[model samples]
Target: MPDVAEVRRRTWVPGRPVDVLATLGPLRRGAHDPTWRVDPDGTLWRGVRTPEGPATLRLSSRPALGEVAASAWGPGATWLLDSLPALLGAGDDVSGFVPRHPRVVAAGRMFSGWRVPRTGLVVEALVPTVLEQKVTGQEAYSAWRRLVRRHGEPAPGAEGRLWVAPAAVTWGRIPSWAWLQAGVDGARSATVVRSVRAAGRLEECVDLDRVSARRRLRAVPGVGVWT
Candidate 1:
């Protein structure tokens, strides 16, 4: 692991309030997910596999400073810093979304700081989503934890035992016996392998329109409306 002196750092001030928790919380697979963690002091840590390489990112919101402080380490440090704004919901456009219902209005007001984050890593998102198909939350999370901890790499600068998810090629290479041992069925495991094999096409969905992206994803054998 690199020392703090070798860390790359950045600060981002969004035009609107950003709820760092709400934005990134959905990405956590479970309380024990090896890819995500929350420190006692409320700092958020994430281990991710960027196109460049693996990285460990630490984020802290400084409301008084009206900015988010971020530090990253590993070969992917620069990529993580460059994508910080989008990962914090800077790309979310809610200007035209009108809430007419009373409950909707109240909910919006209550979660005003919340925005959808875009990590732009298709294989990272898809493998987990496939694992969750038609399974209980407990079952899905267990499978995810098992597979990642077993196959993934230890995050570069993580304070604890956080891990970076396996790359697309790694996901494709996981054997059937390993998948079954992780509690994943043949169908779901096949879907994951097939998706990772075509990871290049799937990743391009990030730049496509919603309709086109759905079409491209649905073209895969096991992917459907729910996936």
Candidate 2:
């Protein structure tokens, strides 16, 4: 195996209290997901699928210190570190979401750390979703776990064995039998294959607004309103 890449670190203070879990939960595909690790100390580790290469990111917040520390490894480390703020919710605008009901206001206040994180990687969002369609959660998560562990590169670092999602080319090349063994049927597998084949165009959806991105994603076969 190649020598592990260098680990890099960055730190910053958020404008408001940042709840790392609330912000990052959506990124975790499932409980058995191979792409993320959340330690007991509240640190969040994620293996990102980037255009440059696989990147591993570790984030920990020190409320008393008033800062969140981020560390990255692998070829895309610099890109991951630079995009930390946006990943951690710096770009979300909630000015228009004032809750009218007392219960809604209380719920919002209770989860003040919640923020929508926009990860520009479209295939990252679409692939697992396709696997999830018309399947039990257990089946989908198991397939994701198996495929990633078998095909993905180990995350950079001395600790966890997390793996980044395989690159689009790798995903596109997974054999038909492999999908069957993973409990993914032909329909779902076909959708996944199609999505990865069109990854370049799907990625461009990131540049579009939410409405346009959704429209673009739906244009891909097997992706529909439910997705």
Candidate 3:
């Protein structure tokens, strides 16, 4: 068995209020997803499948200290901990956004703590996008939730039962029937399979600017604006 690792007590304080759930909640494939959880104490936990391996993370806010404590376990423990701040929206820049309307400004002020998070895992982000093509949100989320629970490796930590998205190779190898069973049509399934076959190239585009990345993604067969 591969050795797993654990890192605990790593913490940081953001300049503004960090609504843990609000910041990272959108990443969850579904409301009842096992990959995302909230503890009784309000700590947020997430499982991710990294290039290295599967990892699980727990985050707790310390209001008095104005910081968030992070703990992670798996072969990707260090990567998860190191990227926690960014995953929690530290790299988001709202300087470019200036709300003109009163309602927009008010909403921004009301949800000041909310920020869009960038997971940095391109293929992970792309998989759901592919699934959602020409389908309803509920259908896409259900397919994602079911597929991940079935094919993904169990997370390393004992904190909770969490599972990561299967590796790119595993994704590429999924049988056509499985996608249908998950409510994904053959066209979308073919696109995802082909995309994962070139996952290495797609992942490398993370270093590229937005335009270049989009162009590269569009070059793949069956991937376009819908994807």
Question: What is the per-residue lDDT of model 1 for residues 17-132, given as tens digits with 9 covering 90 to 100?
Answer: 77788889999999999999888878999999998889999999887778899999888888999999999988889989899999999999999989999998888888899999
Query: Between prediction 1 and prediction 2, which has the larger lDDT?
Result: 1
Q: Report the lDDT of model 2 for residue 182.
A: 84
Worst 10 residues of 3 by lDDT: 1-10
- Weakest lDDT window of 10 consecutive positions for candidate 2: 1-10
Ranking by lDDT: 1, 2, 3
TM-score of each: 0.95, 0.94, 0.92
Candidate 2 RMSD to the real structure: 1.9
For model 2, the superposed segments whose C-alpha errors exceed 4 Å read: 1-3, 158-160
For model 3, the superposed segments whose C-alpha errors exceed 4 Å read 1-5
lDDT of 3 by residue, 107-214 (tens): 999888788887779898888888888988899889998898778877787444777788999998889889899898999888899899899999988789999999
Candidate structures ordered by TM-score, highest first: 1, 2, 3
Q: How many residue pairs clash (N, CA or C atoms closer than 3 angstroms) in each of the candidate models, in the order given?
A: 0, 0, 0
Residue 105 miss distance in model 1 (angstroms): 2.5
- Writing each residue's lDDT as its tens digit, candidate 2 over 18-76 gives 88888989878789799998898988889887776878888998878878899888778
Clashes of 3: 0
**lDDT at 213 for candidate 1?**
92
> Each prediction's Cα lDDT score?
0.90, 0.85, 0.84
